[model samples]
Target: MSAQLPKIFITGATGLVGSALVTELLAKGHHLRALVRTSSAQLPGSVEQVVGELGQPVDLSDSQVVIHAAARVHVMQETTSDPLVEFRAVNVDATLALARQAIAAGVRRFVYISSIKVNGEGTEQGKPFKTNDVPAPADPYGISKMEAEQGLMALAKESDMEVVIIRPVLVYGPGVKANFRSMMNWLNKGIPLPLGRIDNKRSLVALDNLVDLIVTCAQHPAAANQTFLVSDGEDLSTTELLTRMSKALDRPARLLPVPAGLLELSGKLLGKDAVMQRLCGSLQVDISHTRDTLGWVPPVSVDSALRKTADHFLSTL
Candidate 1:
């Protein structure tokens, strides 16, 4: 941090990651211009809001850095007829469009917040995903993100604007929703869960950790044109995660030692195959490059992050 911070233009300011990044940057006295869909979008008082949509023309007059955090995230039950096309429209097409605008506006750096899905869904034990792994995007959302990363890298080669891609695994923290919240509810209710015997490891990134990496790339010269995977650097199994969450909530973990095969079968019978696979799958990432490159490490431990999440969840009750 310097006496004068660079002006940053960021998208998805109201999102989980974006909002956290904004708060962090603002606290550091950085000027931020956020692209929002509406002028009335809720944001901090000092954040300059530019009412606009992605893939559309935007003014980047004096911005020195652009952080692309907005995308059409994966949906559990896709309602669209053509999901890939829809994902491409926002994640790929719009992302490159904005990068081109940043180039034209002479922005110095572009940091893309990508997903680990760019490296495929799950991994085997003792084999984690690295930055150099061949792209094996599984679904429409992952495909779109991979395409966007390619487009950005290509554009970076042709311009002076530096590009840094960060792929983060499951990110959890205060205000988290979906499965994490559901699991918390289940634990809080002292319901028995049949996930005790599952032996799988999954890496997760706390909001503080991911935001720290993003900010590091914003100005770090070594981050230029490099892709990094980030996590808590500690992997956990489904049972471990539930047990830890229960500890945070001060509830006894009522876990039944169900067989993994039986759980998968039950999932298939209930049309929750994907859910079960996620719960029992191992998806780990190697952040050694991130550490060796920028000398960065996760600032928050898993337990600390879980406690923060639990505290927030309890406060809402």
Candidate 2:
């Protein structure tokens, strides 16, 4: 007979990562509980819903593990008077509060889904971000994640509950939104974008690949109290990425050969220098440690993942 899977309590069950994780965990026969704001929130039939927000008291008494996937994600536009404070209210303070509750409830493991921004905004060419590097967060969102990581590490040292942190690069999949989806729309509409001739490598994790790693960290004995960086094990240039995306969407890519320098200048004048940097800059991550440490590998290939994403995008149209 097979052994029973550990009971898991999860946050952000309605978000991209959380929803996918919920499906994956349930498939593996793990009993699941989710924190939701409303009882009407849609989730899998097997998940037990607990209504509450972060920073509020929660009861994880029956759970053996906790996977914290919710966070105050990056804000492209600074709308708040104090963005850091707003981020900390949910990302750091609420995360720590949940950890304390998990500890008190005898939860054995806590898997945190962090971002690659905690490493830095960009990496030097050919010098990928590694697992052990001094964090240099450039924005308030990254800062809050780093602070939460630090707090969790301190808490782990004083408690029996193991803490596992996994920092993932840009995640794209069926339900992806924001810039990735916009790019797909531009390609599908045959928009002439001046993004060709740019040479920059970027690391991205597919939603499925990231979810696989998260589940691995949740149960792997070696994953206890360790931090990991994950990716699709393939790096692609901006031009290559666009080209692949075009192929996946079965659309023609009208990429003009615009120089990167000119694009940067235009972006600077328009107060979008940060946006241009992402297009023209490289941010690679070395996942050797993640591979060696836990014997983990991204189960999905980039092309396959992109094809899936494109299929979803087309289905929604």
Candidate 3:
């Protein structure tokens, strides 16, 4: 890195991934401008805030880097009649618009934060999804992400701007919400869960580790025009995850020894089959390419990250 780091313009400043990213970049002496739809938190007064939504165009002339972390993320229960159309408007159309604007502003690089679902829902045991494999997006949200990647690649081919795409699996850390947070809450409350018997391997990226990768790709010459799968490089089964989480929370894991098959059956009966699959599914990523190609290693250990997340969750109570 140069003594004079490049200015970075990032979207999703309030999100789980983006806020931490802003902090990391700032700590390394980089000036940052963040897009804030609402009053985004965790930023110091020195950082500039660009009040806007994803669909609007922004001035990226002074920025050498653009991190497009904002997107219409996956909705479990989509209310729209045509969800794909809604997803494309922001994820595909608006994202492409932003990339073109960045290119026009002579921004050197664009870092797109994509989802692992673009590679597919889950993989069979011992078979992890690689960045080189063909995409098999299983849902509207994943499909939209693939489309955005394709469009960005096309745009990059016709312009001087470099594009780096990152597809990450479940990202968990302090202040995480949704499923991972719910799991921590359940464990903290000693609520018994029927996931003790399920053996599933899932790759998770710590928030700090992912921020490191984002900053790495922001300027790394080797990372130009590359797509990578990111993880902590440590895979854990459902049972193991619960156990470690319990240890971090200083609570007992009240997981029952229920058969995976029986859990799946009950999930279908209760309209939670998808949730069950997520909790007991195998969704691992092979990050050897990331390590060999980018010379990047996750900066945070999974156990330590989990402990930090547990500490935060406990603090909220």
* C-alpha RMSD values across all candidates: 1.1, 1.0, 1.3
Which runs in model 2 stand beyond 4 Å of their true positions? 1-3
Model 1 misses residue 175 by how many Å?
0.5
lDDT of 2 by residue, 118-190 (tens): 9999998899999999999999999999999999999999999999999999999999999999999999999
Q: Model-by-model lDDT, in order?
A: 0.94, 0.94, 0.91
lDDT per residue as tens, model 3, 1-317: 64579999999877899889878888899988988876555678878988877768777879999999999998877899999999999999999999999998999999999999899999998999999999999999999999999999999999999999999889998889998998888898899988899899999999988989999999889999999999999999999999999999999989999999998999999999888888888999999988998999999999999999999899999
> What's the C-alpha lDDT at position 148 in model 2?
97
lDDT of candidate 1 over 191-235, digit per residue (tens) = 999989989999999999999999999989899999999999999
Candidate 1 vs candidate 2: the lDDT winner is 1
Once fitted onto the true fold, the runs of candidate 3 whose alpha carbons sit more than 4 angstroms away are: 1-3, 38-42
lDDT of 3: 0.91
State the weakest 10-residue window (summed lDDT) of model 3: 37-46
Clashes of each: 0, 0, 0
Clashing pairs in 1: none
